[model samples]
Target: MTPEDRFPGPELPETGPRARLALDPLSYGYESGDHGGPQQPWAGPGYGGQGHGSQGHSGQGHGGQGHGGPGGAAEGAVHSGESSTVRGWFEAGGGATASGFDPDAPGRPPFEPTDPPTLDLGAPVSAAPPAGAPDPLPEPADTAPVGPLYAVGDVHGYLGELRAALYEQGLVDADGHWSAARSRLWFLGDFTDRGPDGIGVIDLVMQLAAEAAAAGGYCRALMGNHELLLLGAHRYADEPVQSSAGTASFLAAWRLNGGQQNDMDRLEPHHIRWLSRLPAVALEDGHLLLHSDTTAYLEYGASIDEVNDTVHELLASDDADGWWDCFRRFTRRFAFRGEAGPAAAGELLEAYGGHRVVHGHSPIPYLTGEAPGEDGRPPLRITGPHVYADELAVAMDGGVTMDGRLLVARLPLE
Candidate 1:
């Protein structure tokens, strides 16, 4: 068999994160004398046997959601608008062969200079109830000009669940359009993968973004590690890249980490652009919002804008190793779980300018060790968002993918 055939494809969800270390380009060039040689910090088994992957930040476990069918590629589908410069560079260095890689693949992206995606930001959208639905009670015309600030946890392609959560908060109307005018909503990231209808979820968020802005409100998102993973697979599929274990590729890693085929097939240019440009960090009402709970973001930039801009620029580049570094770091987690957690949170706040850090990557059940409900189902109530690390951090990933709650909390938890 050819080296390509002998090379292992993506791992199973049950595989330890150590399996990932083999694909982390950053893990290459390191010389360790350990069993598998000097393994990197992320090059280990699951965390404390809690089932966290070696990818560290991915909370996927045996029971975790995201296990799905392989994303099938449309044979011979060449990526259109691909930058010849990027293709040339990769080809020059024996980068992954682009010949048979699926062009419609979700990850490999091309550069296009377009205005940052904006929701309508135009005329006010009239909230009209559907037929047979009672007219919604009118709010006082003098309601607060700027509505409440709220955030959502991970929605791993569970579009129905996300819609329900938003609707419960009155953020969306019965028809699933933005209903809360003048209200700000933020999705903490991980909108796709590991469940059904990831693309549908992105579509909804995109629609609501426009609808919300048109109604004098705004809906925004943050970048998650999965987004980084998807991009890497798209850009460097089957490319033999350096790794601690020898050679690896993003396509294999993405598949093992719950890359949904439907999501990839349905991916469009707009979706790629939007995901690529998502901010890595943001401060709102003294709350610092991050997608993952790792301190690795500091490696990207010294400040919030710097971090986001740096990440965005990196995503635009054709550097395979650079992209892997970003993906690896973003997959780190548990920076605020132990005694030093508060201190870690404080460090982010000190640098990023926020009173508290709000994040969603590690699920709440995993953090608290809360067992699933009776009958092996997820618990009915999560109570509320987890305020931990001496109240310096709040975790919103309620483990929705694991049948856990999908938390939607207002900012500035008191």
Candidate 2:
């Protein structure tokens, strides 16, 4: 059977895992990859509205946009619709698995992560406003437009940083409820591994998804390479794969990276299914949201919809090699940097739809290429989102594993 056969037909209920939101995916413009068959709409409570697709792909709808901001139209009431076609990040390598932003340097994690560290909040490492946020969103100069679009960098299991950052934006109240009624939130991916509370991070994101949808806004996530690792580790558990590096398996890679025992122990079947279904690319309000800044996405498909669909299909199947291939592609990084960076970013924007690429995965410090302190410490402290590659790409991994910040930023960065 084809990959399309892997999914339940339209006759299935939308309430099932990762159901598509009601409303035509086409109305929002762009294509959301649809397997060649009738589509089923998600029966999200209070979530009946038009959904948006990325520039050129077809697949699952990103998020359904409801009433704009305070006025729903004054200006800025927008959803990340940017992530309909989403992918992840990491380094499987040799061009087959890695997409180097630099093309010459190593593309995966520069080093195994430091043990999950706590942020020194007192330090002045906050990302700037309008682009990278630590400050609460100021009252809209005018009526808030559709819930203003916001994208988060990789959480990497840093639940405390995640919660604090979300709270700062007033997205959640002191009690962590969905307070950003109409604002759209997109987590760029990498919800697990290398940190202390991967499971907690997943739980909170899941909770926020339901709460946000109910409140008329939406909270969606793209899958990251770490998710791939977790799933592979779970399913294969040391099952060897064909690798240039002998005897490698997903579990080994995950452990070599920062897979936490607590997280693996806490993972649930629902989480696996949810991760399996995340799209690999998307375009929202002109932003091409992704997990890694690699051109490897092109190999998946020419358009965003095709990329997402292809990824979804692979994840839905039992093709260990196929899944491993997907992991390698998303893990490639630095493709959108250097003299050729603009072209790389342009390539994605040209194919996927979106003016700028917003992604997580490669930490900002890696993008800057700044070495450690003169005294020999880790790389430079990150100041949140790193806008480089001639501004075509925005790197949002704040080096949280290294005790740097976790960023949650507004898009179209003022």
Candidate 3:
């Protein structure tokens, strides 16, 4: 069954104070070496033991609840209170597997191995309702302004930073998960690549969508070029393709961009299928959400859904060069940075039907001249989530992968 179908709990109420759910801290295990007991493997690619990967999945169960109060605790497991334990699971196998237990399986016992496992107990346990308990519908906060929309820039596998930024924005709790009620969150894409835990980032976002929807809010993500590249590499790695710059291959680009060897090794059929099905653009609350800030979308279709459908159809084709070109064009950034950038921004606004365009493919630091190692220049600080471009575009990418902040903010009604 689909996640929505599997998680058909009561919808959170549309009017009330923000409902808070305390999450118990959870633990996980990792295999060391091929023997799967925390030892480095000395042989061929190690699958480890069946139960050596569980840390991140434990945390994922409570991701939609705001991160606050006492964290949950794991029952009958060794606890390694290291956030890296969660990171390792996402990065370990390139995020191919789901680390957490299935929430839908209420009676499924936790994985128990015969051998001692590398355990990670994240946070303390909380005595909250059981996973299958009927959740009270959360009421919407009338006091808050309407059209409470938010956009996140590229996550790029920096799960810790993304969580911290979400908390800072009051969207999540201290644990780096979502919690706000009756709010809308739009991710501008590029969730993986060039950092640790790209897979982890995607897993978190996917989990949040279920959580947020249950809580009377919504979390939606756009398809970024990196996602396309990752999917392409997994499906068409051995297939060569032509590019604007020259002949290019997704596998080569993925590796050059620090694609984790573990990720490629763990590329699963489901992950590729999900990435392939991602939509290209999303529009909500008078804002346009996309990965890149270019007018090239006109080449696809007129309506937002049409464009997404067209792109999906193209990606499904066997024409490797066409797919690569689409990936390359989407990867381009800084279309709204310079003096002439406003014109390009206007063209997009005219097509996409949003007063403002929110995107993450290009980070805000790169636009404001604060990115590290930019010709020996010092980094610049991002003061807020919204960056106005000729008063038509909002750059949401906070450059979290490069030590910049992650942008998270509610959309203000005009």
Candidate 4:
């Protein structure tokens, strides 16, 4: 039976291991009498020398002379008289023929074939098989856009404001529970560390995640600098970190960065673990959602997965300095407000494979320089979400922590 017929009517396993080997028969060449083993037949010129096809003579110890026969003596004599001599038997289809001689001392030079075997050194090397099909990336379920993903800007422990914002966006009911059926919700991550009820905010979001997923929608979060700062402060409070500015402690920085004493007091082990596990960015529905707007993420990794993994790994490490740098970078914002803003946003969009970036590190009011209660005047009205970087980025931090409105809106389909 043919090889194909041998496996007829049988199901082959889709995923299994297989072994393979390659054979190259005519890889080298030789002169007349020189012969290679069956496996390596060709022994063209320079087959056993320094350049090209040379596989230096082995076992025939004394340089060029093979030790067993009368031909050995002739080869030794030729080598003795000349500084450089090619001494080897040139075999033909008929029998062994001796070639190459000492041109200086010899009375008559030995018969030299006009066209000796020339090595084809330009033969191509075997290439490795194309990389085994890469493990496929996780593909979005269907072409149909999933849901109207709405991410809440920094709640900063302001539970009342968070509830009001959710209710206003039709995501919650009168009882203050998630009511947006099958609508994806995400907290753009500063769940704690500013106002009262930081833990309450997290509790609400976690409960909402379960509720949303159970109802065929999903609720997730990304790690903000506050999360990392809080984690670092709790885990390495006693550790001192040396920075370019000066020696600073994580606990101190956290407090100065609006970390509330009550929130830190209420922090538990599970909360710390959960915060540390939060990714720095989440790509959802063609949007790259992150907390900060800095290119420092490029230093974390080249790809989205790499950046997330590296950031999480660094947060897990006990190196206070590394964690501090991560926190510092994560807090930087307004990268899209300057001349290089477009290029910076483009870099992030390319790396994360997103059409636009949605972030919460900088509040829209701050970007617009219209913070409320400033200069003893009323706050300017913000009718809608702020789109910056020529509409390539959206800033959602509405400064709710400072009594400004918390933003909750559907991603613009356009």
Using lDDT as the measure, which candidate wins?
1
Encode model 1's per-residue lDDT on 295-400: one tens digit a residue.
8788888999899889988988888878876776676666776556677888889999988999998766545544342235444356668887778888888777
Q: Which ranges of candidate 2 are over 4 A from the true structure?
A: 1-145, 371-379
**Candidate 4 local Cα displacement, residue 227, angstroms:** 0.5
- Predicted structure 1: lDDT: 0.60
TM-score to true structure, per model: 0.68, 0.65, 0.63, 0.63
lDDT of 3 by residue, 1-414 (tens): 211011111111111221111100111111111122321211110011211112212132223331111222222432122212222322222211112222232221122222211112122212121133213333343453332577777776667778876766667656645566556778878777655567777777876776666555667788887787777767665355654333455654554333444455455666666678888888777787778766667678888978998898988788777787677556545555455566767777788788777776655544554434314555556655545455677766665544456666555423
> Candidate 4: deviation at residue 77, Å?
99
Q: Candidates' lDDT values, in order?
A: 0.60, 0.56, 0.51, 0.53
Once fitted onto the true fold, the runs of candidate 1 whose alpha carbons sit more than 4 angstroms away are 1-145, 371-381
Ranked by TM-score, the better of candidates 1 and 4 is 1
* Of 2 and 4, the candidate ranking higher by lDDT: 2
Candidate 4 local Cα displacement, residue 300, angstroms: 0.6
For each of the candidates, give the backbone clash count.
11, 38, 32, 14
Error of 2 at 195 (Å): 0.7
- Model 3 misplaced stretches (Cα beyond 4 Å): 1-147, 175-177, 374-376
